[model samples]
Target: MLNLAKIGHFFLHLWRGVRELSGDDAYVQYLKHHAAFHANAVDVAPALSRKAFFKLWQDSQWKDVRRCC
Candidate 1:
């Protein structure tokens, strides 16, 4: 089981990687929006837990955007 601190660190790293790869604040904002949307959906639907939602979103094609270069 992952601790809260470890989970936080993992997310921080993910955000940093996304920011670095995209090199655009807009993409980061979009990613956050998608994450929030999925989070809310899972909250409202007990059948969909946060972990499962996050995993699904992480592998979702919607989360993939071309790098700005």
Candidate 2:
């Protein structure tokens, strides 16, 4: 099974990538053009669910999940 800490780390990386991509005009244009196609797309796990996930995450003894890499 994948560790929760690793999962959190992966999400952090994904968020960063999204932020960066959103800043690029080309990416923005692509998103605009493909808005309908990707409209239903959702993150594997969302940042909003972090709090709930973290509670379970902490219970897993992965408390250092937030430690800077």
Q: What would the TM-scores of all predictions be? A: 0.33, 0.32
Candidate RMSDs in Å, in order, are 11.3, 16.7
Identify the runs in model 2 with alpha carbons over 4 angstroms from their true place.
Answer: 24-69
- Residue 21 CA error for candidate 2 (Å)? 0.5
Superposed by TM-score, candidate 2 places the C-alpha of residue 19 at a distance from the truth, in angstroms, of: 0.2
Highest-TM-score candidate: 1
For residue 32, what is the lDDT in candidate 1?
A: 69
Model 2, span 1-69: residue lDDT tens: 879999999999998788766542334443454565666777532232435544554466555564665
Query: How much does candidate 1 score in TM-score?
Result: 0.33
Which tens-of-lDDT digit does each residue in 23-62 have in candidate 1? 4344445466666777756445333455565566457736
The TM-score of candidate 2 is 0.32
The 10 consecutive residues of candidate 2 with the worst lDDT sum are 44-53
In candidate 1, how many Å is residue 10 off? 0.3
